[model samples]
Target: MSAVEAAPRVEGRSNRGTATWMVVPALVLLIGFFALPYLTIITMSLREASTRAVYGEGFTLAHYTTALGDFYIWGILGRTLLIGATVTVISLLLGYPVAYHLAKSRSRWTSLLYIFVLSPLLVGLVVRTFAWMIILSNNGVANQALKATGLIDFPLQLMNNSLGVTIALTHVFLPFIILPLLGNLQAISPDLAMASRSLGASRMRTFWKVTLPLSMPGIQAGTILVFVLSISAYVTPAMLGGTGGRTMSVLVVQYLVDNFRWPAGAALAIIMAAVAVIFVGLYLRLTARAMRRLP
Candidate 1:
């Protein structure tokens, strides 16, 4: 073979080796961190707490049975889903416009916009939760402003409730939604819309037919991220939410910290992880099928 012909085979083998090397480290880390911990939790969930063994001495369906049978656990699971769904919807509504606007802007403007969008990540979650607490309290700035404006005689009930937790979570997770969406939007070529316009399609039709469909990946990614994060969140809900608004994380913390129920806490954590995995898997499958049909 000529040098050029031989080069292809050599380059292909080099690329394959490089891919193997790159993948090995990631696989190792995934097993060492995620897979190992998950297995440990599953083992704990299967075992009896008193014996601290996986089978025979400790093996029982009791932990899983208790988790499934307990009304309080089910209630908190429902609340967590509700809160996560609410926050995900709100984040999508609030973040999509910001993301779309930024994506459509010039590069300089987009860069500046990202700084503002990502600023919240710099602040501690506790601090942000407390800030919301201060603003949403009955005598806080929000209520004070409403009173000053004569919007209501009484301060609107904003703090220590589901509404407050939703708002806070939406605020906290907004940037995650925006960045993913913005990236996805940016990846789409403006030429598609311009081509549609040239073919006499209106702006709204172009958006619906071309832009929106193309942006679905970002929407899916952002929604999954926001939903998972919001559902698993601890600090925001615990701070802003009252008893009625308590989420699965709060319940897990209560079990682990207050109740010192290690096995039950592990069980709750397993359930929470399972829920997140299922939701994300469903989202990915749905989005993949949608994307396959898009063209």
Candidate 2:
């Protein structure tokens, strides 16, 4: 080979070596932590449930059969899904404007605005759930305000139900949706909106036809994130849901820890994982069609 060609090959090899070295740590962590633990969970889920042994003695499909056949478990799954969908919708509705404002903002206080958006996440989740409990209680601030305004005579049953769970979850995951959406919105060129407006379209119409379509990617990502997180959440549901709003995550914890049914818990976990995967995959496919021709 000529000297010049040999030198390029040598440099390419060095670059690939450096890239491989950089990827090793992340690869190791994924295999050791994420992949192995997930495989262990799947293995445990396939085993029989037993009180005598933590993970059970032999493999059986009883756990899956029992869980799937139980009407009560199905009820909890439905409620969990409903809460997740509600929270995702509410969060998107509230988050989009905030994200849009943040993306278009040139104010010096933009940093402060971002902190305000993220302030709820900075607090411990347990603490936030407790705060919701206080506010949603019978004589809590909401009821008291309603009474003061002559809206009602009796205290409302706000906590220990799906409504309370939905409200709290929406508040908790709102920032998550907003951040990704803000990043997506910022990436869209402003000139596209400007050009639409220059063509005699109203600002509202321009945004409706131009900005919203372009922001679908952000919407898809944010909704999926909120949906997954809200469905899998345990603390807020356990605290506010009480008996009426137990989700799959809470049920899994009850079986695994409180009830000493690891195999059952693992089965429930796997079921949830499968459903999440299917739902997210379907979501991606639908959104993919819309985003195929992004300019």
Candidate 3:
């Protein structure tokens, strides 16, 4: 009885050890790369600013106080949030139709269209931002085309502003929204829409009443992804925004790199991450409630 019982126990212990060893590399990487950096940021955020060094020796809440108290910082935060929301909404509006067509149509060009949508993403972000800068400049293609068409007497101020940043960001992230919506649209059976049509529902009516509701999960996922990425973006904002279009991410970089205020930068980064997490939480709660209300 002792040998039999001990044999199974030993085998069970060996299996458990094997599983633990399998997970150890992942745990080590997470702790070493993510957990340690995030913990360091939290510690840095609570410290005082140092003139002679990256951070001071004493504990202080001054960085948090400064970040929260300053109206300029709040304005940047507000703009970041606003842009993020705007981009998400615009991406949804533009992407949905393209996604629907891609999912439903049997055109020969479908693969090409998909490639076109994703091609921008294949290029580096910095390269894409610089390209936008060229196109949006005063005498660039956009202004030249408008002027040639007699749409305006002068070049539109497209670059170095919020509008430029928003436009570029929308373009950059549009594929993200489209891909998810396409997947969701494809998951939906065509028979539902066809059945509604057979039952005398108009095409538009069937779309609104049947198709749209089923697509909410995809919409929510895409919106959250676009918004989070938009808010956290740094290079696009820096290149297109200049001073007038400054966002929270740009400010974080300024604090850390230009001003050498590590504590302040760390505080700002933490705050930004917190805001994103809170927004995601609230969005998920609201989405769940909405889903529950649906059939």
Candidate 4:
């Protein structure tokens, strides 16, 4: 065979070897960091705590039953899900347009737009939550301006409630939604859009049919990110929500810290992890199915 023919086989073998080597490190890390910890937590969740011991060594489903049996816990879970859903919808509504704008615009403007979207991440979450607290406080700038303009008879109660948590979280995670969305949008070649337009489709129709479908991966990715973060969020909800809109994470912290109930807290943590995994798996499967249908 010619050298060129031999080169293909050699290169294929090298690539396979490289991939195999790469996977060893990944497997090691996953086993040591992710898998082992997950197993430990699951084991811990199955045990109960005793007053004399840190945890009762015996296996029992009592902790799970106790945690799941509470109506208040379910209410808190429902509220968390509501917040996550609301945040996700709002993020998509807001981020999709920004992503489309960034992806379709001239390449020169992309860096500036990315910086603008991601700048908020530079600040700490506490700082951002506190800043929102000030903005929505009864005497804060937002209320003051509204009162100044006579928009309302009284200051809007934006702080210490779900509204405050939602607003802060939306701002906090906007970049996560925007970046993935922009990536998906940018990956779609402009030729597709141009070709659709050439076929006499209106801009709106072309976007609805072409751009949006192509960008579903990003939209799904951002949605998962926003939802998971919103569900597990503690700082924003704790600072802004208080008792009125407490999340599961806040309750988990309370159980662990205030009540000194490790087993219950561990059970809650396991549930949160399971929820996150399920959400991610569903998202991946949906995205994969969409991709399979595409071409």
Candidate 5:
């Protein structure tokens, strides 16, 4: 090679080496904290149960077998999945319009609107779940308001049920979807939307054809985040979910902490995680098909 060309190649090699060095620390942390812990949990899940100890001498798949074959466990798993799907759909529907408005607005209400989006995240999750408990209790604010408005003759059963858990979870995770979506919307060039209008497309039609397609990345990211969070949530479900609302997270905690069955709990957690991975994979594929190719 010529001296000039050889110099550029040597520089490129040095740059690549530097980049690899920069990435090493992150890879170490991920493997140490994230990957290793997950591997331990997977190992725990395969361990045999013992009456005298947390695990027996040899490993077995009995935990998985017992969990999957239990019809009662399957029922809770189904309910958990249903709640996750419901929360994802609701958050997307509600978050999109708010995100879109915040992205485009220049008015005085913009700051006030931004506060609403951030307010939920300001409070701690446990504290917020407690607040929901008060609001959702039989004679609490929501039921009292309903009674005052003659919407009902008596206080409705709100807390200690799936409905209450769902409502609280939706509020808690709403901000997660909006923030990602707002970023995505703001990143979109106004020119693309404007050009669509310049070609005589109406505002609504322009959004559907141009803006929405471009924002699919945000939609995909936000929905996946919300869905995963909802499924893995423990606090809200434990606080609001009575027997009827108890989810897999709550059940897993019972096994690990209350029951002291670490192997069983680990198995359940692995099952839940495996199911989440499968669903997320399929969801990504579906969303990928709809995503517009970007330059």
Candidate 6:
């Protein structure tokens, strides 16, 4: 090639080099923080559980074996899955209407409504959990209101249980479901529902057939997100559920902090991560197939 041809090639290479250089910092940060720590966890998980040391010598699968054999761990895992599923379903059920209204409404109050829905998220998880503790306590506002209304003879056992954890978690994760659903609902054209109605469909029918199907992508996204977060949640469960509301994450923390079993904790954490990944993957695959079959 001539000098003129080589000049353009040199300029292209320089541009590519600049782009690579610009991305280097982000790559370094990801590897240093996220990737390295995750790899360390995997490494630590293979070690034997030790009370005195961070990790014991030699590789052993005892931690994983213990997790599998221990009925308490299984119970915690079951509770984690149950709570996560419950929270996801409840959030979706409650959030859909709010999200639909937000997407469809053109009123001045829509902005205010949006802000109100997001207000809970602005509060810290610990603060929100503490607030729930107050509201659900024996002499708290909820019981007082119930008593004033003659709804019950005594205060309900709302605190320090799975119900309290679920309630707080549902509130905490509602916005996650709503935001995604709202985006999906907004992308749908109003004319589709109108057209369905024009073809002799009732409002409910039109919504069931036309609106619901189209909003499924958002539902899938929100459900996966909420479920993952719920399964991994620790603070709300620990604060609200007390001794009975132990989940996988709480168990992991107990192993590490309370029991001083770092290897066992790491193994449990790895198992949690694996389960989440598998669940999400299967869900996505099923959702994709279902969507593809839709007309």
RMSD (CA, angstroms), candidate 6: 2.4
Candidate number with greatest TM-score: 2
Better of 1 and 4 by lDDT: 1
Colliding residue pairs in candidate 5: none
TM-score of every candidate: 0.89, 0.96, 0.91, 0.89, 0.95, 0.91
lDDT of 3 at 278: 95
Worst 10 residues of 6 by lDDT: 48-57
Query: Which 10 residues in a row give candidate 2 its minimum summed lDDT?
Result: 48-57
Off by over 4 Å in 1: 1-18, 50-57, 107-110
Judged by lDDT relative to the true structure, which candidate is superior, 3 or 5?
5
Output the TM-score of candidate 2: 0.96
Summarize candidate 3's per-residue lDDT along 2-77 as a digit string, tens digits: 9987998899999999999999999999999999999999999999888998778899988888889999888999
Superposed model 5: Cα runs more than 4 Å off = 1-4, 292-295
Model 6 agreement with the true structure over 1-295: per-residue lDDT tens digits: 9999899999999999999999999999999999999999998899976657777778999889988898988888888889999999999999999999999899999999999899989998899889999998789889999999999999998877778888999999999999999999999999999999999999999998889999999999999999999999999998888877878898899988998888889999999999889888999999888888766
The lDDT for every candidate, in the order shown, is 0.87, 0.92, 0.92, 0.87, 0.93, 0.91
lDDT-better candidate, 5 vs 6: 5
Question: How would the candidate models be sorted by TM-score, starting from the highest?
Answer: 2, 5, 3, 6, 1, 4
TM accuracy, model 5: 0.95
Instruction: Compose the digit string of candidate 5's lDDT tens values, residues 1-295.
Output: 7898799889999999999999999999999999999999999988888879878889999999999999999999999999999999999999999999999999998999999898999999999998998899997999989999999998888988788989999998999999999999999999999999999999999988889989999999999999999999999999999999999999999999999898999999999999999999999998887673543
Query: Per-residue error at 111 for model 3, in Å?
Result: 0.5
Q: Candidate 1, TM-score vs. the true structure?
A: 0.89
* Better model by lDDT: candidate 1 vs candidate 5: 5
